[model samples]
Target: MEKVRQATDSTVEMPPATGRWKLIGPGIVAAATGVGAGDLVATLIAGSRFGYALLWAAVIGCIVKIALAEGSARYHLATGSTMLDGWRSLGRWTSWYFGTYIILWGFVYGATAMSATALPLAALFPILPLWAWAMISGLACALFVALNRYEMFENVMKFFIGLMFVIVAGVALLVGPNLGEAVQGLIPSIPEGSAIYTLGLIGGVGGTITMASYGYWVNAKGWRNPAWMGIMRLDNRVAYVVTGIFVIAMLIIGAELLYTAQIALSSGDRGLLDLDAVLEQRFGPFVSKLFLVGFFATSVSSILGVWHGVSLLFADFVRNHIKGETGISREGLETTPAFRFYLFWLTIPPMILLYFGRPFLLVIIYGALGAFFMPFLAITLIWLLNSSRVPAQWRSGWLSNGLLAIAALLFIVLCINEVIGLLG
Candidate 1:
């Protein structure tokens, strides 16, 4: 009954969204969750190393993410089921893989996200030590997410997205990017020694595990039927457009400011710190401080988005698998005990890794699982959307199939690259 075979008649008869513009919460949340501080660093490092030669890769990255988010949301809207419901229909193996992956992924990601958010704060305030700031940041975000409903969480994320747009994009303008060269960079050509960065920009722009949660967020926004399909697509595409702007802005700043000066930044979240120092030295203290605020906005939004969205995902998994609730899925995932428990899992347990370094075996497993998730999502989505699980009217067309296939191939390469690094 969870398969969408019976829903075709009602799905086809549903009316169009009255006003698509106003129906734009989940997409914004998805974008905020997807474009984190690490994503900015990867984009920045690419530009710093290769200037705008990889701009085409950044542009393509957004397009790929649009396909992914659209496919995920389409399944939800068409079937009126969560993504977990679709995956469950495939077999038991999907559950086994996701169960192992989400637990390990959350444990590792919790520490990484908290520390990322704390880095700029520690530099800005200098009152708390880094681990103290990380702990405080984790607890504060947990409390905030715990108290708020989806609407509050969404509004705050919107505010942070606005904050990021202004600061990061404003700084990009201040740096005076080379327009003519940027235009040239739009053509798809790889520079010497730029393969890894291009692959990262293509694969890691919007999200990893959080991509699977787009449907949960879509359901949370009350868009449960196929009538909402038009608005959902609009929301998904616009979200990635904003994501494109954020990454492209960072790339511009890197190319204009760091590339020409022959300055190389440290990799990972610390690279943004390096950019902060560069901003202060070149522009002044105020600009650098503003950039740090943007960095915090980026990190904090991602932390909260993951906390809220992925918790909904875990809650849905529990509802369908353990409880065996096969009736029409309720929009109650956010309120479930499983949701809060996962939130606690995300916020508390990982703080230990911040003080004591991540255990080697744990890191290896997490990295391997994290690397494989995108490919798994892409392949499984293609299968689900094309199979009888989704309604025929809303099944994968040529365009969706094409984009997802490309994503699968790209992600497979990235996963291999990740596993090799983890092992070797």
Candidate 2:
């Protein structure tokens, strides 16, 4: 009920990040978590369908996410509060929305992420069935997060991002991209009926709810004040730039390997598997296996990230709203009962979905609720950062405002389409 002032804490270290690249952690986590198998597959599909015609949209997508992630992280660094705290200050509606979302989304996504991650592992080693692999991988990821601290989790994510980079970039290069046509695509041309397709590429660039988790990761990494803002920006930018490049690489693969060859890939996580099979046929077993390894990294990264980050969010949500108790910092939410509970929620219960198909009603509800999360996050960030809830100097400038506004609009479009598809 009181407006807190001052952006920086005197006790926190304020060292310059001039030559300290290794000091960055949260951004890498955000990047790894954001660019999951779904994002990559979507990009690959775009490339396969339109070749390099939509390259500029992928680039712009990264820029949009950079703004959103940076805005979320900046709010934390500048105000010393989590996004949830800011959202709570807005209205009680924020609480209800997130409460429903984290529950349904986590339940459904647990099965989906496990299934996606398991697909490659199952393909690699046929000894186990997909459902068993899904449960094992999901539980294993939850265990790893529950056992380790953010420091260790971040290190593992770094490895995964690195693996993703090497594999996607390698495949892109191996396909020998056409520099000239790619340059032409940068000018932005509408390829007939590709409006919705192009929008999906832009909207699905990095991630959805994970962007809201950026601040928690920021706090988890000891960036609890505005002093860390400079390095945080640099870290956020570099991560999404790498994300952009990674998507671009996938696009190139789709263009050269799939588009030119007149190959079609399925949509969603299965699309990555389709790509892997295509790679095996076209490039050989080694290349296909390498892509599978990368696929494992991408999906696993998403699992670990959602397992940890969203748990922290749920913990905070429980702390302030459900429990009606406070005093726990956002950074400190990782150790809470609610945190571990959500982690378990993400791991075990979803295994049932892996066996019995998701209930049609449940799936529809999940889709309808999950669709608005990004729009909710973007709009809320815009509200919080532009209000007096943040320090005067640290509030969003016109450029930041513009980007957040654009992100909110774009996500709303995506939300509408998804909801109509689900309910219609």
Candidate 3:
């Protein structure tokens, strides 16, 4: 492999060309990161309430994410710059917004993610309390990320994803989904009073801030040039395909298990625990325990994914904005002060929230900030990829533009709904 100098003058080692199947790492990580326990719960709730009516929304959600992820990855390979770099190029305000958002979001998300991951662990082994397991989970994920690099992280995520796929999808199948109704779900129709849930399913499917991290993962995987575009596309496609399947499986469970029974689960991670009890009653302890283990895998994988991916974004922000670096380089990110600082920021400080509960004001702000991130991502990608900033050959085509526009509109509506909900 020869070193290729990007437009930013950063030297990236060009990885050897491999078959499409072999180029499927970052996407897997992205998929695993995006589909957490909350997503499953949301999908499950949608299925349980609306049956398969919103199944189209989940599939559309996957398609929208494919566009977002593809655009992010394409920008990195096209310009040899990170997404932060592109944002920086847009204006200083973008930098300011992201810097503030990352700090606040990570502070809150750290506690939430740790708690979610700890739920299944506590259920499986009730020796420890939830907060204790949360602290341990946080420490374990941070240590694993801090100790290893991209390859190990990706491999471990893949294993977790595979485990989740088998368990969740298997459970969905075991529930004996109504195939005819599920196929009907393919048509775009929203039952009355189902608007919010429909939008949520569409917008929330396998999406998170981790979608922005897709580019950083691409670079970490050593795919830094335009030549890897095809591979990136293939990788992105496979990621969402897997995501679609996982989400559909959850919908199946929700539809068959909960909807048919007219059982309503509570909101949040606790709902998953509630589901576990239901499973135990319906299918016995073994199947219920298997679902809990799968839940652990799903939740823990997100913790690890964010621990690694968002840390990279923070590292890039520091490198470009503070350290005066021109381009992103992988050498220092895993070991750099900024990287470790944010990693520590994500791990340690939030433990307080785990014990005492999140501050009300901070929760509000976090909610407002998070509500707008998807729209922010969608709008920015449209501006960056369609403009002269990206190379002419790599600029977004009509399909990309249309999909992104739809995503932006969808997220904007969702953001407004979020604000209204918060205010109400």
Candidate 4:
């Protein structure tokens, strides 16, 4: 295999052709990271309010994410640059924007992710207070990621994904989904007042910034050149296919069980707990407990995924911008002080927020930043993949461009709506 010199002053050897399907770690990590408790609640809400009405939205959401992830991976493999590196090449302003957004985003999201992970553990045990569980969850994930290297982290994520799939899919089956209605859901139609829900389902199926982290994860998995492109595509497909199934299963449960019962869940992560109560009442304690365990898996996996993946991004940002590093080297990033600093940033300070609660202004800023990220990502991806930034063969084709454009428009509208809601 030929080796190419990357900006990081390292040689990237083209991976040998083998069973590409076997190289599937990063996609699983991204998939697990994307489907948090919030996604489950959103799908449940959609199903309960308009049974199978927004199912097409979920499918489309997976497709959109697949394109985004693929573009990110393609950029890294083609140019030997991280997403942060690509953004930096766009301009220093891009670097400043991302650097600022990620810091603020991480502060607020740490608390949010920790709390979400804590909820199910608290429900299952009833021994620890929510705050305590939240702290423990944060510390536990921090230690796990801090201790393990990429391979170990990937394996752990795979276990969580499998556990979540079996439990959630099992519950959906137990709920007895109406197959005919599910099939009909493939046709697009928005019931009255379902426009926002439909859009949210389409735009918010799996993740936000985590989509960008897909490249970092792929890099961490040692896939460095265009030779890995086919494997990367397969990995991405399998990831979202799992994501689609997990989401569809939740919608089925909501459509069959909650929609039929006319029971509406409360908003936020609490809504998942409400589903647990309903599940216990409808089935038994065992099923409800099983669902909560799956919920815990989903939330904790996000914590772990973000802790590992985004930390890599942060480390890369610091390397390219702060340290004046031109190339992205895996060993350099993994061992850098910046990586450890961001890992600590993700873990410790957020625990203080867990105790004191996120302040009002910080939450507002976080919400605003979070709202625009998907649009920012989409537009930048279109620019990066289509421009001379990437090689001709590696550049996005018309179909990829079309999907990404549609994704950009969808997210821009969603960003506008979110901003309006925040201001309102």
Candidate 5:
């Protein structure tokens, strides 16, 4: 580990990362991970319910993700510290909070992601049951991430993300055009009786705590200075903007194709299967198959992303905190107590959740913690980057701060809504 200079000197003296395209690593992976099946379903529901009226919400979601992600990355570049390190600096309690939250979150999320990836496969080929396919997905992702080659993992993630973009965007085109109405959606408006979908669309669009894991991606890319900061922001904006467009395309398909249909989507992973039935009925077997393929791409991208990225975060947390080391050594990150521990944390315990299914209490806890994370990240970024720890050049600008403030309030509202939803 390089000696961590004082935060002040670290900001000024760090070597700038060379090359243009090379700096895009973590932001792309984070964007891929953040845009999952749930995000797609929320956009779909919004489009189906409100036509293009809720398109603005998708844009809001993208903007918020960029802000939060940029903040996280900024904290890392400025201080030469991971977000976990930044959190620990705030207090030992912050570390405990994150540790406990991540463990619980991983157990619940791993099952959810595996089942999500499985549902599409099961829908495509019903010879095997859903749980069996889910196990295969879990094992596959675990084995792949366990390989521990960062470049190889990023390439694989980019491939799946590309497939998801093509199929989902292709389907949107096949559904045909209503550019006049689509353009109108660019204007913000809440239609009658569509408040819930609007809220969901706004809140769910490509937003996830996994976005926080982007900094690790940046660090992995060897970007470690204020000079790399501009590239980082640009990479972040471009990624989430792609994420926004993908979501908007999905929403357009849902609005144009399914608005008049009387079908209802089941909540959770079942919803995608329900959507497959609709596709099969409306289009044909080929369309249904395509939808399932796209579903698998989206779900598996998320599974692989979280499996790899969050485990990296968990591992780094251990190396930094428990071991009293600096960032994971190049070799140590691949083979360390922290890395292997979170690999199991992500892969093993979650299989049990698959067998038992998601308990109501577990679901509630997941939702509660998940809802609170964006606000927490936003708040912490504001605290860390705006303080003496960050150089003025690396700090968030006024516009960025304004956006983060809005994001913080939006997440606070989401947390309240989640709590109320859980209680009900």
Candidate 6:
């Protein structure tokens, strides 16, 4: 393939310039943020419960992410509008759904993200309490977002993503995972009693609401037009490819080590915590520590990414809708008051949840809404990207559409399973 060029324009109205790696920015961060503790737990659980039976699903998850991320990037490139702006164009109902979802998702996700970041910290430093570490993680992530330039955050995320991949891939290699079983998983059979977890792994590994923020990241990276479209696709593919490998490595570790050892994993993020213990038991304390460091890097990168990226998205939603500032002609959303307001919402109010712990009701609602968000994003992207609004040059190809449709269906099934699980 010919090398795709980068975007040159800083102003919102112009098309992004041509070049490679030149426009790298928050899109990568958003990708990192979308893969959090819950995702890891889901992937690891699939591995532990059924070895490499879901490995193919995990790879499929990566492709699904690439499609969604590409759709988001295309939306921004074609219209030079944020995804929020595109949705608002659809109608007020879209805005209402988005607004309510963000408020609820942010409130609950803040606690969960922090707790995840803190787990590795607590594991590394027993001197500090888990709650204390959680608070510190929250405050630190918020402060990082508030103080730093977007480029700085992106570089940090890139570094951590590299570190995460190295550690995870290394462990997977060291464990002698069953490649034969892993290959078979690509065919997509549903294992008995394991459908729920398998679906969750497929849906969860792909992305979260943060994936919708891909445009903002692209915008931040100076990708402002159709010229940058090729590079944007490459960037999305590379990021998810790396992410897929990391997840597959985790699954292999689960299969080779955890399954072989016969360790019964718990249900949520705690299962990952349990995995940490099992690592120590099987491979010695040093390997466990290394895994914890990788785990901490993964979680903290996620916290910082969400704190920064989605805050940008929510802020843009407010700026575009409530403030009536939409399109490329206006000032960027990052500097708008609505952006700061959501930033504060992400940082300050969630501190309450940090101390008090998420209420049972809030957790339940968060799970239900959270489970449904992927399907919503997929369906919305398909609708919005295919609409007349998107420039024909940047429209998704049939292959992309097919992948995204499969993504939407996978998440729909996952959402159904979640609702059933929650209700039952």
Judged by TM-score relative to the true structure, which candidate is superior, 2 or 3? 2
Better of 1 and 2 by lDDT: 1
Better of 2 and 3 by lDDT: 3
Q: Compose the digit string of candidate 4's lDDT tens values, residues 183-264.
A: 9998999999999999999899786788899988887888877777888999999999999999999999999988988999
Put down candidate 2 lDDT per residue, 133-199, tens digits, no spaces.
9989988998999899989999999999899899999999998999999999898887987888788
CA shift at 50, candidate 3, in angstroms?
0.5
Pairs that collide in candidate 4 are 7-327, 8-327
Model 2 residue 153 CA deviation (Å) reads 0.6
Best by lDDT: 3
Task: Arrange candidates by lDDT, descending.
Answer: 3, 1, 4, 2, 5, 6
Better of 1 and 3 by lDDT: 3
| Cα misplacement distance, residue 181 of candidate 2 (Å) | 0.7
- The lDDT of model 5 is 0.79
Compared with the true structure, all predictions reach lDDT values of 0.87, 0.86, 0.89, 0.87, 0.79, 0.78
Task: Estimate TM-scores for all models.
Answer: 0.96, 0.97, 0.96, 0.96, 0.93, 0.92
Per-residue lDDT of candidate 3, residues 331-405 (tens digit)? 558888888888899999999998899998898889898998999999999998987778789999999999999
Locate the minimum summed-lDDT window of 10 residues in model 4: 1-10
Residue 242: error of model 5 in Å? 1.0
